[model samples]
Target: MMAATKRIALGAVVTALIAGLAGCSGLGTGGAGSAPGAGKESAPGAEGNSPAAAPKGAVNLIGDGSTAFTGAQPELPRAKRLKPGQKPPQFVVFSWDGAGEDSQKLFSHFRAVAKKYDAKMTYFLSGVYLLPEEKKELYNPPQHAAGRSDIGFNDTEGIRQTLAELRAAWLDGNEIGTHFNGHFCGPDGGVGTWSVEEWKSEISQAKAFVKSWKTNTPALKGEGPLPFDYDKELIGARTPCLEGQKNMVAAARTMGFRYDSSGVGNQVWPTKKDGIWDLPLQLVPVPGRAFETLSMDYNFMFNQSGTTQGDPDKHEYWGNQMRDGLLQAFDRAYSGNRAPLIIGNHFESWNGGTYMRAIEETIKTVCTKRDVQCVSFRQLADWLDAQDPATLARLGTLKVGQKPKPGWTAFLAGTAPGKAAVGPVPARPADQPAGKGPDGSGD
Candidate 1:
């Protein structure tokens, strides 16, 4: 999504400008080494490491982008077989559009909860966040923006800071994925309203941005931070506003994305005729707003007031729904229900202060108590692909009160740090003196 006028002279400025244009910004675990607690240790195929053969009887807990509500999946009947090898549903949490301090706070919040139970946190960032640090060449966007000051997008300085912090977190071990910028169906004037072509451009550009960082930058040199070390074309996404379009899916696959988390539990796979992996989010519903959207789950977690598009209420309600909804969903799913509990949130909706505190409360009540497995999308994918013959049939009758299988906790705790890199990673170029320069007054 670069401006057509001209390329920026300095990489950093151009990067920031581009971010301004894009309003850029910026998971879970599952399977054998799965569980909310599984995150404490390392798994072979997790993050960027080589895939280890999954052990027998491993169950993955999955989640999706930021969203959690009460009585959302009110009627999911259980699975039939409830077999040992079958993968459990996921809880994939997305970082709402682009990157910011909220992104970091959300990541930190998720990290705290996941770590408390040793669960993994899945993160998706906007490419704009990486521009100031990774694309710092004079020939980059920064130069162009510096020259014109307003020619491009991005808060070169702010994004730079966020990237530095994110890099550090990834090194500590986290799943960093891709959340498409300007593609989801957002509020009026939101990025989602962009044309299909613009949406395609957005997705491609974000992927390209990350790909460049993994290969072109010195700071990221060999550290293999997430979303980078793994598939150069990490194709996971949460549509803005959870809105899904047919053309968007086609564009995503074309751009080399392999997964889409926009689908809801009520919808089946291939719902759109495309072969894209439909990682539908399972959402809960608020008591009064049940009639609003018949498609996805109604969220009671956010108070039903205020000007927020998603929740009419501005009150932070994640704490109220976390336990009752999660336990109820788990009970329904384990008892052979086909419905998966899809929890979600926005960067602004669930970060720091009350939101963070609420999530922590939920973790203590739900994840730590039962067989919950907060998992990554890929981990869920792997588990789903390995289901036994009778597993699907047993969803409706699975029992509760059984001791969660052992071994995953050990795996989570036993994880060794991935490939070592020398020296500390770099700060955003905007922070460096190199970033201050002669205004690109033009040629």
Candidate 2:
């Protein structure tokens, strides 16, 4: 179905996002403990879709390159232009915040799960994870003491392990976006109060952590560098505490960021803000309540238990609460309007590991279902961009949980002139199409 060419202004489409309304950044509920929320927060950050550059049999390296311009990233299936008259696939994005393979080993565990389901995820890597703890002082965060990080830095072994996972994850076609350094939140130097310059400083430092990990960490002196170029690879992020997004978006747009997942939204089609995609965390139906909850585990905990450690007896119930709510949210989009579902998580075993179980089960339950594509934010943005403006404008017309009247085929039956618009695919550096089996059998 070729699409119409209508466009809608963002302010008219996303009423949930109040301009200049502040909310706290960072959820601070993963790993060990949950911190108090910041006093303020706000919604906040293009065409993300570019085809994999097919390389011609060799690798190219940039100057002082900690990573190489490797051939087309393997294991990714080619995303074709959706044919006209076809319904959009149900896109479910499972993203991790403060991504690290810590003592819990959740990162590695989830990697295996994503592989089992042929799913791709976004890992928002906190830069300090790559930076050795001993070198913390090197990070000069704006407005704070040098080397100070709300999220603890890593040791050499941890860094090495994280690097290995990140390398493997990228090679497996996952995205590595920044979670920035120093997971600071709240009014006392929380990211909510940072200026555009400070946010830029934070971003630069985040990149510095990943790009210069080896230069700073002596133990990694001889080990292999990260697999991909950090400079060109990073294009999106989620702000800490979800605060300072008002300024973060401004800073990110200038840095070529393609998307930002910092605010809360209803289950609706996304639109642009600050010249990039504003893919916010959404509010989903709470299973047993009339009200909805944020599509994140920490928020569930915050509401249910007031912190990461909730009541032991209700842990199972809490897990089920999240699982059922996410599935409920999925059904509303899957069966109703066909809007994309964005879920955020951490690697911690919060509330007795119930949330982990919920996420894992959700993955197994949904990814294999018909018309479902568990993709990355980058992929989602690209898909949205490739679409016709009129089609998107029509999609935006369907409010939260509202189905297209007279059915999808009839609603999308009309086509304007021209070929079906296609999303941009990154040109690969290799001859073989990505995700081709090593044996040359596409299987």
Best-performing candidate as measured by TM-score: 2
Highest-lDDT candidate: 2
TM-score of predicted structure 1: 0.54
Instruction: Show how many residue pairs clash in every candidate, following the order shown.
Output: 96, 38
| Residue 346, candidate 2: alpha-carbon lDDT | 78
Q: After superposition, how far is residue 357 of candidate 1 from its true place, in Å?
A: 3.2
lDDT score, residue 443, model 1?
A: 6
lDDT of 2 at 104: 67
Q: RMSD (Cα, Å) of candidate 1?
A: 19.3
lDDT of 1 by residue, 308-331 (tens): 233323233423433333444444
Q: Candidate 2's residue-wise lDDT over 1-443, tens digit each?
A: 00111112233223221122111222223432222111011000013244356566555655444566775566555454445556778889999988876556777889889888868899999888877767889989878998887676877767777777888888877889988878777677888889999999999888888887768887687877676778767889998767789899899888878899987677888888878989998876555443455688776666556556666877777787778778877877887678899999877777799989999999998888888888888777767777777777667767666666567775665656333322222211111222322233321
